[model samples]
Target: MPRIALIGGNARPITTAHELGVDVVLVHEEGRYEPDFADYCSRILHAPIGDSAAILEVLRPLHAEQPFDAVLSATEYAAIAAGEVADALGVPGTTARTARALKDKAETRRLLDEHDLSPIRHAMVASEQETADFAESVGGRIVVKPADGVASLHVHVVESREDAATAFKQLREAGYTRAIAEEYLEGPVVSVDTFSHRGRHVVFGMSEYQMNDRFVEWEVSTPSRVAAPHRAELTELVGRLLDVVGLTDGPAHSEFVLTPTGPKVLESHDRFAGSGAPELVRRACGVDLYRMFLAVQLGFEELPQTSPVNDHGAAIRFFTPQPGTLKEITGLDTVDALVLTVPPGEAKGNIVPLLSRTREAEVVVVITRHPGDTLPELRSVKDCSSGYVIATGKDADEATAICERVVDQICFHVE
Candidate 1:
């Protein structure tokens, strides 16, 4: 068996790694921690994020003592560091420059600007004054976020100068040296998953991502049901971006906006899509993205072709309770797939649970092949019921309706 070193071995990709029959080395302990199964080769290396020196200290001895074939990264930060390690260890990985550019929001914006691919006006701010000035210059609403982070942490849209200043102060205090403030593009957010090998790029699939009113991501559905003609244009834009960024290989997750003007690149990751997105893509289109990523890391030239397996649609909905103890959960029967964050009893407030902390809620995913899948129209609410429902369909309208219904059935309790 080929020995492979996996960084950031969390539950999301562990199952796929097990199925691939490769050695697994977990880099982070944020999720469930455990030893490898007796049948599979696995180990836990105690190295946390932001401590690249320690990771090297531990892996250096192992590289000298054992013969590992390749090193793969399962997280954004880890992947950025792995690129540097791969250079030193003579292994295949993303270039450190590319990784850094992808990981840092400010750097990404600069690159896009240089390539003339940036569709919206953007600025990097280090202080409240700078944020206000940029917001004024842009003239429209602005979206602000940490220069480098994931999961939309500290992401907020500022409708006024006051909001911009407050957001900047909070982010600066949180140790984010700078934040990117860009024009808030109006339209649906879409996630495009793709893989590249030796300059050959393939778009695994595209999904329309839905978010709650508060800007928390809800779910993702394939063959984006927003508009039909936007698919090809989005794919071409992604390909052009890959070429511009000089991203030659590995798995990539790119998020963009299907605005009235055109597709605007929100950001891109040189790693596999997170949030069980890889699995969702696999179900919608018969592509094992995780497996393909491993192949690229190992210098494979081609990936297996895949087609949609089922005509029916699939979706995953996330759930969060009101600002109180998570007493219980109900109404799961309306969905097909589910994952929970808070157990039956736990204190929950504001749904701003830290990613490094415990899982605060669960996800209920749904899939159906029913023809003309029509869901009851839903009225958007303010609190209690907060989350996203990911759905796919044969056409955009069918998928949109299912998503609306899934959103409606979700209800929450807090006291």
Candidate 2:
């Protein structure tokens, strides 16, 4: 039997790995790891709490004993660490340089600027005055975020000096020492997932991104219903970006904005697509991205055969109900794909509001076989459809209309 060792196994990708029939050897502590499905392997390894050197030390003995056939890093930090270990262990993986470029927002933007890919007007600010000045110099309105953070933590859209000050203060309170402010691009956002092996990159699928506020991503749907012209343009642009970035192996997930000027790259991840993206893509397309990555790590010369498995699109929407004691949920039976981040009866701390807050109460996802299914059909029937809905359409107008319907559904309830 082939054995695969996975670091950062505390994430969504671990579930994907389990779904793909790969035995998972979790590196994190037993209590911290959670899987939605049954695991084939009951093995557990304690992970280093803070230091990378400590993690390496813990893994050194495991590598000698189990002698894994492949190793996968689930998180950005782990990916960077895994790169070095892969080289030492002669296991195939991403380079530390590539992982760094993708993980650090400041470095990512700088590299993109240097490549003349998308000229992002941005600055690294450590103080309120510097943030205000940077925003003013970049024309006042800007998007501010942490250089190395995930889940849209401490992200803000500053419209003026005052807004920048508030955003800076919030970042400081959140323990962020530095943040990057860039000219906010006004347009719809989309995410693309790809797989690269032996210098060849294959585009798996593209999905539309729905944001709750400035930083929280609420939904992702595959086969984004985008205008034909824009879709063609984006496809071409993404292909070129993969070449430019030299993404030669493993998986890549990139986000871009479809602006009037054209498609601009927002960010990219040099790992398996996050969230339930791998599963969503697999449902839409026959590709099992996790298994493909596993094959890549094992040095398989030929890639797996992947094509659209279903004619219809699939989408997922995350929700955060009014942050309070979990009373009850009323709409799970009505939805096709639903995952509650916080179970019922859980006290959700004061979540940020949609306009200013970055988190939600829960997440609801919908999958449909019909291309014409509107967002209204996907909306939760409870509370008169007041909660947020994220839908994926076969093509752009469908996606846009679905998003509009989701926005409309969210307005049914007002605090």
Candidate 3:
């Protein structure tokens, strides 16, 4: 069997690779080991966190001993490492330039603007003053975020210089010295999942998001209700954006907001969509995106034609609670039967630790909340999530109804 070097274990890419009769060698950061991977992974390699040099040192010997067919990563943070390893080994995968652009928001925006694919104005600012100036220049309202982040962490919407200054300060204090101030574009957010082989684009799915006040996604529904024409337009636009960013092979996630003018690219990454989206796509299209990504990288020329597996809708709703001491929760049995559910992935406890206090904490609170726990102080997504509710229905409305039913039936009591 051919071997693939997987750079992260955050998703079920290992299981997918294994099921496809491919061997996955799991490489992850030290102290972040996942025992679940042992069953599917052939070997486990570790390197210092955020140290690509150390990761390369680790992969070199492994490659020499047993040549890898491809280097793969399904996580945003590890995409660059995957690219570097692939380049060194002359394998099929993302290029170093594309991976770097995906990791740096400032670079992505600049590239998009240069290509005339993105109309929004943005700047990478170092200090609160610079952020304030950019906000003023962009008509007072701006979006501020760390130059490097994932899953909406440390992102802020600012309407005034004060908001910009405050957001910039919080970002710096959080150890991110550089931040991007962007023109706040308003619209519904959606994710476009695409596959490319040597620059040939194939768009398979688009998922719509319901976001909270802080712009954190609260719920996600796949096979977006976007009209056919608009969907086609979005498909064309995203394909061009991928080419602009130089994505040559494998899977990529590109998020966009449909503005009054048209669909504008928000951000793009070379990975499968996070937040339970793989299951969503599977429920909608019957496509194992993780597996397909690996197969394409391993040089599969003709893939199985993809189409909707069902007309029914699939949705994921997060369980977010107010800040208070945990008391009890109910409705597990009732909520569990609603649909195929991926459990809200944490254990319940007496006092849920608040993850962070920044603006991100508000959305992050709900982002991380579990289904059946009491959170005394809801801080960030990391500490407050109790669980998530996944549902499938005959249509989008029906799917939403199932999710809503889960919400209505499940109860969290805190004091």
Candidate 4:
């Protein structure tokens, strides 16, 4: 079996790696390993995935002894470091320079500006004053987010200089030293998932999302509803991104907004789109992106074209509820479309939890309240979730309808 070096401790990739019959030597931080991951891995090297020096120190000796066939990572925290390691080991993967630029939003914007890949105007700000100035310059309406944000955390739309300054302070307090403020663009956002090999990008799939009141992605429908002409346009744009970012291999989840002017990239991640997206891809197209990532790293000279597996639409919906302590949760096991569900007890319980910038609380005083373990209040996407529900149907509308039935049945009695 070919030995592979996988950076990070995400269990999904580990389980898939095992299925591929590859010996996985996981390089991860201390205490980052999932309990079940050990069963699939051949060896575990505990070190911070971000520490290139430490990772190299461990992998250098191992490579000299047995030699790893490939080095790769599926997690954002480990992608850059994984690339650096691959470069040091003389393996094929994304270059360390490319990985670094793609990981930081500010850096990505700068490169896009330099390359004329996007028309979106943006600036990086480290202080409230800088944020206020940028917002003013952008007609007093802008989107502010952490320079290195992931999973859409701390992404906010500020309509005024005051809001921008406030957002800036909140981000700084949250440990984000630098942030990006860009002219707010109004449009529908679609994701283009692709696989790149030797500077060639192949479109894998596209997904569109439905955001909750708080702007958290509550539902994602795959095989996006984008028309054929626009789909081709988006594909070409993603190809340009791949070239500019220097991602020669592996998967990319590139998001773009369909602005009236044209389609422009919001941001792109050099990894598989999370939230059960790989499963959606498998159902829509006969492509296993997880397997592809591994195969490429393991030195597959050419990847075969995948035919459509089924003519259907797939959707994943996350549970969002009103904030309060949980009195009881029902219909946990009843949903047929349920793909992942974490118990209420296992999830967090909170009353009047701090909402994200986009979400607002509707005050209603209740006469009676049920007493039970506290349920986590819904705030951002990172907040404790009841888990996700996945459904497949003949079309996007049908898939969403199935998801609605599951969502309606799952109830949380919050006080």
* lDDT tens per residue, model 1, 333-377: 655435334331121212211221211222243221111222211
In candidate 4, which residue pairs get closer than 3 Å at backbone N, Cα or C atoms, i.e. clash? Answer: 348-375, 348-376, 349-374, 349-375, 349-376, 350-375
What lDDT tens digits, residue by residue, belong to model 2 across residues 1-415?
5566677643344554565566666566434444331354546677652234655677678778877666667665577666666666776667667777777888888777777877778889998888888877877578888998765667788887888889989899989989988888878888877787776666777877666654555566777655235766666666666666666787888888888888888888887555456655764665767667765656544665443434546554544444323334444454443323333212111111121111121224321111221223222211112234444456334544554544434322212
Best-to-worst order by TM-score is: 4, 3, 1, 2
Q: Which candidate model has the greater TM-score, 1 or 3?
A: 3
Per residue, candidate 4 scores C-alpha lDDT tens digits across 1-415 of: 8888888836656776788788899998765454556899988888889887889988898899999888888878888888888888998667788888889888888889889987687988888888888887877578889878776678878887678778987897889888888888777888888887777788878888887544577778878886344887897899998888888778888988888888998988888886667766765665777778887656643655532434777776766667767677667565553133223332222111111110121111111123464445555766535445566777767877777787788777777
Report the C-alpha lDDT of model 3 over 47-70, residue by residue, as the tens digit.
Answer: 753556777788888889998888
TM for every model, in the order presented, reads: 0.80, 0.76, 0.87, 0.87
Compared with the true structure, all predictions reach lDDT values of 0.63, 0.60, 0.70, 0.72
**Model 2 regions more than 4 Å off:** 10-24, 35-38, 48-50, 243-246, 299-301, 304-310, 331-415
lDDT of 3: 0.70
Backbone clash count for every predicted candidate, in the order shown: 14, 13, 15, 6
Instruction: Find the 10 residues in a row with the least total lDDT in model 1.
Output: 368-377
What would the C-alpha RMSD of candidate 1 be, to one decimal place?
7.3
